[model samples]
Target: MNNWIIITPEGITKSPNDTFYENFQVLGFVTATTKEAALVKLKENYSYINGSGFDEVWIYQLRFSNPNITYLGIEQEEDEFEDDFEREMVHKITCILEENCYTDITYDYFEEDSYFFEAYSDAFQEVRVDVKDETIEVYDRYIAEKHFVHFGDIKL
Candidate 1:
């Protein structure tokens, strides 16, 4: 009851006006059953994640079994995971996703996390500094990172 896979969470959510918000990009899971419907769902999520927010792309692979659900980190055979494996994993089962949780192997690929840019960056990849007005901005759009500015920081 074990399907090897990966789970990478980046956080992809932004405002329509290209403003910075609680946005991220990260989801990599190994799929089981290979159902066309399931595949469609996965692909849709991937597209939406990549299409939105700064061009931050995250890909995860997931392979799991019935009861042995596992959301492996990302894939760092040598490195250890930051998540508390046994402690964080809850058996309450919130949403039964294909009856498969994750695989035994997991690693993380923080393409744009705290380590990538400023520590407080919501979307680190888009983090930028404006010398014209001495302002800090986290570009929210891949097509237009300059479209957004801190709500109150925009000097009139």
Candidate 2:
């Protein structure tokens, strides 16, 4: 299976008295055999309402194995972590050897021991994490490096 990113147009309402705002929203990530299958899977899994003012959903296949280009979003604050585990995990993930680099944790389904992250400097980078035997494997596609750290080693 391959990883894919789904994006859709969304309208946000700040408050009852505010006007509706339009923007592109990331639906989520899905794994499938192909792009068409990924779209079908996403539509079936997510209750996305299709209608006026909303553009067609855009799907992009993520090249995790040998990714050279990735999306770079705004820098996120480190204080978003709710606990020590999250804080440590984010720290370890974003410790890239690049100057002026920014990292965004796109997905952090920690309950499933899975994470999706993107980092940017001169080029975009993607990182995927998988946990096995209490050890987390960090795959940094941009640097073409793999890092393994035991969960116990992550000081809480």
Candidate 3:
């Protein structure tokens, strides 16, 4: 079965103070064996149901036909553990620093399989690690100084 989504155009809602606000939101979604069935249901609901606050609604059929993708369905199995590469990188960096006599270590935000970490041994230094690529780079100053940039070339 294919998944379908119904999106409604932006509409205005008047608050008690007569203040109006607009929003574009999803009306609902459904699963059907065919796109025609989903479109029919979407039209029926929008025409005869309590769909009042919107000017227009659109129907989208979710296509999962890409060979490189696999859907996990709606259920997660017990004993299933997802691997977190970023956490592994943090742990590796922490262990390396501890072994090398770097103390007072801490880490900030993990995103896109990368994170910035800092450690002090009478001097402050920051390092960014990309877990997916197994690359580590050092920063000359505190992480706050270069929080916006992701590229650092000094490998460790």
Candidate 4:
């Protein structure tokens, strides 16, 4: 059986045009026999927040694999370390993550040229994954402050 998880966007709203705020909450996993079954459960539980035009629900396939490392293009010294592939890979990923300042940075402008951040137990690394209808919008903290209050739970 395949496992799937639904990310419910709690306290999510648009403060202005092209700007949105939402604290994504994990709604737990759903056991199903196929991808279609998982999606069916997602659609069944979908609900819209009151007076909130946002209706998109994000779902992901749960994988048990180790987190992937994103390789950001960074210049490395040829003799930095003697054949230390893991160290080299970690350094490159760290460089890309640092350049973005670690604030929900996303890159999808070009195919095979996009990046995302994933924090593991001890370090942060970049990973490549095809985003479905992925959008990276500017978060307006000022506007979010005035319109929303987080209650530490789903407000439904």
Candidate 5:
């Protein structure tokens, strides 16, 4: 049974966009004092990607002039202390990412368990649909934790 997670605009076909055709570490505005501050922040740091074939994702932050902290890029992979061969691979991926950076201070990382920052892209096509037609899931991690804490008296 493959667990599925779907994130789409309100009325999408309810398909999971989880499989990445391509991904990049991108950043956009979060909350800036002034519009100028937002622009400056976006100018210094942000995230984006071009192309396809992505399996995992991560999110992180970046620094810019006005000392503004902007959300940047979505990435995959894990570790950081990369070997030479890995470094070369990351460079290739970074090239693609940088080429697609419509924002400032963009970089890429193609390593194991990559660092991803939320608020990466500003492009989303929302899809809205009636929930009754889909098999939706309601999960609560807290409930699971409580179950283990008091395993004897389980309640449905």
Candidate 6:
């Protein structure tokens, strides 16, 4: 059996205007033959996932070869590595924001974009940075607001 990491948002969806921050929680690790089987095992064993209120969840296969690496068994608390995860995620976001001249960070997640940070220069603007893709998009807040209201669209 292979180990897998299960991740999901902390709670239900929030208002579009609410400040967005990364709050992904690692549900825990499960042993299964495949990713699909791992998810099935998690759903069957963990009641939290059934009522998690999240639209989706992600799973990553855990693979390591370092003989010196310590292994925290599956019985370890779920939050054991949460602080490190949060620090890394926040650092990446902060770097992206700083590199693009965005300060006083107020970030939020759009259903479409997953997560975005907002900052103002002369006028209100919404900045969406896709760290995985190494891409950034900036939009006028007014335009974003209008699009969000009329079309439920935030990506451009």
Regions of model 2 farther than 4 Å from truth: 10-21, 48-55, 65-156
The sequence of per-residue lDDT tens digits that candidate 2 reaches over residues 79-132 is: 666688866765664553222244443544354676656654323456566655
The order of the candidates by lDDT, greatest first, is 3, 2, 6, 4, 1, 5
Candidate 4 off by > 4 Å? 10-21, 42-54, 65-156
User: Which has the better lDDT: candidate 2, or candidate 5?
Assistant: 2
- Per-candidate TM-scores read 0.21, 0.35, 0.33, 0.26, 0.22, 0.34
Displacement of the residue 62 alpha carbon in candidate 1, Å: 10
Give the residue spans of candidate 3 off by over 4 A: 1-83, 143-156
Overall lDDT per candidate, in order of appearance: 0.31, 0.57, 0.58, 0.43, 0.29, 0.55
In lDDT terms, which candidate is top? 3
Tell me the deviation in Å of residue 80 in model 2: 9.9
Better structure of 5 and 6 per lDDT: 6
Q: Please report the TM-score between candidate 6 and the true structure.
A: 0.34
Best by TM-score: 2
lDDT (0-100) at residue 79 of candidate 5? Answer: 53
lDDT of 3 by residue, 63-143 (tens): 642213244485755422235654566677777666666676767656675566666543345755555444565433542
- In angstroms, give how far residue 47 of model 3 lies from its true place: 70
lDDT of 4 by residue, 58-110 (tens): 66776742335565676655554334643444355445444544433333222
Q: Write the per-residue lDDT of candidate 6 for residues 1-156, one digit (tens) a residue.
A: 886877776544344568656677666567789999998998776655576576578898877311122434647444422356444554566565556555556545434433455554332456554433444344334222334211122122
The TM-score measured for candidate 3 stands at 0.33
**Clashing residue pairs for model 3:** none
